[model samples]
Target: MDLTEQPTFAFDVFSKACPSRGTLEHVTGRWGALTLGALYEGSFRFNELRRRVDGVSEKMLSQTLHALERDGLVHREAQPTNPPRVDYELTPLGREVAERLLSLIHFVQGHMDGILEARERYDTARGGR
Candidate 1:
């Protein structure tokens, strides 16, 4: 099909029905953010990932990995061990996204103190929740 023949759709994240919005949510959700950030170090097995991500349940990790795998960001490989060793790694696309996430994380880290202070001031002004 020629370029002209290809149909195009508008992508507006503000729209309630945008697919990219859902993808954005999935990638930046607490579990997705932590999982991808941890994988930036290297591939890890299921338990290893669980330990690295901190506070992620087995079900959440499994679901996150599967979602990322579906999005072509994460790679899942299984070794033929007696118990079957499954390793998870970031694809090049995933690395690109992970790098962006790392930048966001660093920004949050640098701003956390101020953020907490703001929260405190806001809470105090509101008579403490």
Candidate 2:
């Protein structure tokens, strides 16, 4: 291989040392998932994203955005304006990921009633702990 050539890596998320694990965590984490799902709708300003994600704190949203941006799953655009507008949107990769996540989200939502019943049964069996 040429000295200037970069080595290709085959990443496996199951490996403890794999970098993909970090990206997976970022994409699947509570705030990260919520943030990505919100961005899937369309581009949103920082405050708008915060509002869309609902329960996420400003600090958490900022951190989640930073992680997603670092992972190449989100794009942050800052405009030169009086108020300094900043917008967040999903990259193509981000959109692809969001599409998959949305499928899971919909599946869980559709089965929520059954899930609740299962949970109730489990709780009752465990003495309502």
Identify the leading candidate in terms of lDDT.
Answer: 2
Give candidate 1 misplaced runs (Cα > 4 Å): 1-10
- Which residue pairs come into collision in candidate 2? none
lDDT by residue for model 1 over 1-129, one digit each (tens)?
787674565887768988878777878999998888999999999999999999999999999999999888899999999989999999999999999999999999999999999999999999998
Kindly report which residue stretches of model 2 are placed more than 4 angstroms away from their true locations once superposed.
1-9
Overall local distance difference test of candidate 2: 0.94
Q: lDDT for every model?
A: 0.92, 0.94
lDDT string for model 2 (1-129, tens) is 898876666886777999999999999999998889989999999999998999899999999999999999999999999989999999999999999998988999999999999999999999997
Candidate 1: minimum summed lDDT over ten consecutive residues — where?
1-10
- Reference-based TM-score of each model: 0.88, 0.92
